[model samples]
Target: MEMSSIVLRMSPTLITNVRIFDGLSVVSDCGYILIEFGNIQQISKFPLPTAPGWNIVDGSNSTLIPGLIDAHVHVYQDLKFIETAIQYGVTTVLDMHNESEWFKKMKLVADEKNDVADIQSAGLAATVKNGWPSAILRMTAAADATLETRISGWPDITDNETADQYVATNKAAGASFIKLMQEDGCALSLPFPTRPIPTPPLEVQKAVVDAAHRNNMLAVAHALTNDSVLQMLHAGVDGITHSSVEPINESVISAFKDTNAFIIPTFAVHASSSGEDRHTRQRLAADLADTREKENFLGCLHIMQAGYSIQNSYEQITILKEAGVDILCGTDSSEHLVGTRAGASVLHELWLYVNRCGFTPIEALASATSKIAERFKMKDRGIIEAGRKADLVLVKGNPTESIDSLNDIIGVWRNGERVVWE
Candidate 1:
């Protein structure tokens, strides 16, 4: 049970006779991988000679993939969230927005503990006086005083000066990227203080994007409607965090192509919003024993208006993928959100990609692995290669053929250390 003992036993580990998905594509039908000092030492089709003290894992009839990355998440201050995510083979989570102080604390935990998934955070999203998450939070947790205080402290960015200051402050506080909020709450059924929630003006949004670039950070936007998506693209942000729920259009495709940006889609959250994929959520959470956690997964936001549907989100994703737009995997999963469980939602998201969107199973896997790492610029971990971090997932069947096979996880390793799933 000792951490040092676990690390000592796992290092110099050999996984033999496995089907390997190297993130981009299937590399070997049957092969071996050597792990040493928390990194992949060698991988090949030929057999490797065993060494003294090596822990050999028989991987016959299994598929070995790079550890999954949940490209969109909100770690907030929950150590358990990161811990739970790794149990499901999510080795990394990109925290889209969180309080800076809380993220720093969580980052320290991730840095020190191999049992938890690593995190990259966009500390605090850019905001206006009465913008995005504030409205949503008010609707969901209006009675929580701490939440109100946190919202009160968010910067009221009105122009270039404030935008520059916000970016600089966030970057200095350890944000890996910048997130812009552009929701007007029109697509959702939630009652807001204002009908069309006050969004940042186009000029302010452009200024935030420019400031983010100046600070050498990628700027991704949160938008749920076509007009909001178009506005963010025009402002030159690098990615859209969520696909619009209002259906795909030629203009949306053109705007994405024009900006050469990527999209996270976050179909898991979209499904929750429309209450269209309850059965899928139920299926995924079937094994959970905790009543609250099970209900959390089963819950739906049911926030989308009558005309808006998750099908539209799926169609938007399909068209965007067909247009050759990079689709990174994200779930927008957070403790506060209904219909999302930290690590489990990543599976739900990938399932939707292959089942609902037109992605092949391999493509869906890549979206959560290589594609996310590529778009987010994380060079150390997505692909299976020599000298890369030994963050990996071994499933019982070929997930390359059946996305659901991923649910049958045999083992998970983070930094060459085996995760002791609870």
Candidate 2:
């Protein structure tokens, strides 16, 4: 069939007889959804009357769900990253940290194109001199002068004054949230100039969080150890972008409960860091014919310390879930991040949640959908309610029962327009 023939335009479209997973749970065993003018006009368990001009998709033996959300990604100027994401049913990605101008261009692409995943960026994370990602990047990507220049331009947040300025600048640059860097480079095996990287002080982190709150933006932090997690929670941030590499402990659980913060748990990246999950990545990359893309998916970082393991990350997620702390799905997938591909890694992340962490397929699905929207305050696109944005995915089987069924994507719609995959 010609791609144009499959494309659903701005006119009304009806997908009927599909099992509906409305972000939270299975809402209907079989149902119909009506999309009009970029929004879900209506949804019903029974049939809906159709008109001649309406585009109708007979979703027999299929499942329709809210488009998946990748809660932690780094979409730094790669348009193809966003384009490839939508093809896999990831309709939205929360960019953890990106250069402001690059994010501006990326946002324009998402705003103008229905074929790309929508993005919410943190623009530039709160950083200090020679801290976090910069130290890691210096080791991994030191050859790239352009990246080094961009790193140099990142804000050197020192005290309350610099912290407030950093938040204001990012918010003005269209940052939906504030990303705080709490890494001290202790968990990684990389040989840094300093054994422990220069992380911002707790008081400075609190200032950034307070500034974000005053601007009505959420503050999410990156921490890889139990101590760092506790510090961020004490700083009063809204969430942790990555799970602690260390084992879960009571202090961590209590701190999370005290702050009521959610965790994104970018397990895909953790697997890469620890050199675990290579077999899973190999399975996920089996269909790729492109040499570079396949290698990117297969590559492992092997940067984590000897004692650190992805199993610890899994146990942390299990404990956090049991403690009533919310878990949001994120992969930390980026153009340069080894062992992760944008969009495709979300499937691996959810699969690990179900198969490794003892989560039911439905719970894994919710981590990527409604739970992300709820934690991120994105009100429009996570559920199959009337008047919500019609970011929907159609798969061959019920992913609610089998998490791996997400790989069989039949169709994806962003803003009520079907993506014309090439």
Candidate 3:
């Protein structure tokens, strides 16, 4: 679909929406929301007359939503991947598990490099003392000098003193948030792992969180097991990356709720048949050396079923809402979708919550949008209102009732530019 290039050049553009979700609720018959210099200048009521020098669009039958915020993504991998995001209506992305400063610089490039995804980053990941098994460690030096240079600043800490330095150093250098690889080998189904994994020493976890808090930045922990999640919560971290593996018992669900902890479940790239699933955690057992993979695989199936069943049977989502535990939508999709990514990854996650978690479609979008902004201390964007960022998505249907309708993306606007979706 072709859009007028000159339209964005206008000082003010009006998107007369059919349905607009105004953060907390949907505004039916909302009129055009004025856009100026990539920020929302005004939100006028319906039937308002079109103004001079303004780009006007007819949308009395569609739904207008704030541009989606993908809380987790890897735009820096290829660097041009943000284009895919704009085409799909994701205006903001949190680079959860990438090289921190590199991603920060890449984010700058995306801003000036092209009209693409907005990138934020967590610096070099902080894993356990023996955490984060690197592929680089596996290569042997051609009989002489072996290549073994671990990434610098991957602080291996077991106590508070070391943890403080790790987080503080990352924050001082420029980290959007602190990421914790809270365990190793816990993901038994991975293709390579042959044994059990250990959680980051609870002291180290607590210290890391304390450091982040002291620096005024939130700490995000990559915790997969229920035990690890508990440790993270006890440490007082800001966010837990994923929900504990399935068969989420009432006790575990209640524990999260009790702490008012926010779990941003990235369901797209679940368990890989190969290496670690990118983001948090150390080496995951990939494929298999023996039929041993089968027993663990079946064990995983039981755990997952029980977890998912309990998550649903107990209405964990509804409980989360009731207790005011923020639920954010984060997709661990890679830029190229290598093990994960590509079409509908984030969307698929939203569907899982709506269809499986018992949340209304609007609630699901909120999980990905406002909740992220609010939780991450994002002062700009994430909502449709005056004085907020002018990142908006014009869709053809009311997704509030059915999230599946979000697929009908018509036009996406970021920084007030009408993104060309080809």
Candidate 4:
């Protein structure tokens, strides 16, 4: 499809009378923002007179904040998923997994003028033989499903050399970062893992992290239990994709503070496992008007039957926060995955931080905005500053006062182009 022609005619927009949250904190008074040529030209406390070429918008004292970023997602081939994300004001997604070829194609679209959320992907994550995802696939796929087709394309690393190769291949394929799977599947708290699940040895995981560092890329590990989290911590990974499923103790707190690694936590998926699917679905339906998203939520509800301990995960985050461990927001959403619907679930995550995990509103907002960009090294677009890309959202009320107000999205703009969901 062609890029929207209407955005071409609507440059030099001047949005005035808006409460600006520049990704860190909320501004006390109303302000004005100027957009020109797909970038923020100015942000001012006092309104400036509009020029002839400017399309002025009176925001009527509504909230304007940087468009949200989902720190973790597994985007399959569906491009509409990105569009749905933008409709909910999630402007960028850090994709944790997908095939390299498909990721490259999606990245191209992210660069185009289409009304979709931008993507920075891992391309293909490093896994080992008979590991976490292999077990997940076996459980999800039909009995007649061919194993080779499912696992052949995945990069399976056995030694340091193979681990290095895996990182190199992903970097060459335009990966934004390196993702290493360290989960043993039992951490998922499902009953099917009758025996101990396989995972890469710590040395191999360390080699991959070293290779990624040599490439000047961030290495994020997928860990769900204390053992896996410690293994990845010992490997010196830059970040953890999920928090420890076990209780947070002094040892774990000391390890996190000592390493100074950030965490994504992805509590939405944990909430699904912990039997909060009904509450999640009701919240999504109450806040969003999109029927497609509602239907997707129904599909996700079916995937949440497996029991997992969300209380432990929530406590882990609380302990980590008290220990001053940096946290970033991510939903781990995908069309194929259960428990998370893209775009909308990130807000739910912030809600969890505030209502359950003991985070202030601004801190929760920072996890999805500035902190994500800083952690991922996305230098350009996280804040609503002059010279940043004009990826922004306008909501009806102040989100700083009540995060649920984010659901009242009045408008969205990507690269200075006003996004119309239809």
lDDT, residue 344, model 3: 43
**How far out, in Å, is residue 1 in model 4?**
13
For residue 156, model 2's alpha carbon misses the true position, in angstroms, by 0.7
How many residue pairs of model 3 clash at the backbone? Answer: 17
Regions of candidate 3 where Cα sits further than 4 Å from its true position: 1-10, 48-52, 133-153, 191-194, 271-324, 336-339
167-257: candidate 2 lDDT, tens digit per residue: 8889999999999999988889899999789988889889999999999999999999999999999999999999998889899999998
lDDT against the true structure, each candidate: 0.91, 0.91, 0.65, 0.82
The TM-score obtained by model 4 is: 0.93
Q: Write the per-residue lDDT of candidate 4 for residues 117-233, one digit (tens) a residue.
A: 999998888987777677776777557555667578788888999988898888998898999998766655445554566778888888999999999999998988787788898
Per-model TM against the reference: 0.97, 0.97, 0.81, 0.93
Q: Given candidate 1, what's the lDDT at residue 96? A: 89
The per-prediction CA RMSD against the true structure, in angstroms, equals 2.0, 2.9, 7.8, 2.7
- TM-score pick, better of 2 and 3: 2
Give the lDDT of residue 327 in candidate 2: 95
Off by more than 4 A, model 1? 1-10
Q: 58-140, model 3: which lDDT tens digit per residue?
A: 77778888878877765545655677666667778887766655676776665663257777878666765335533212321
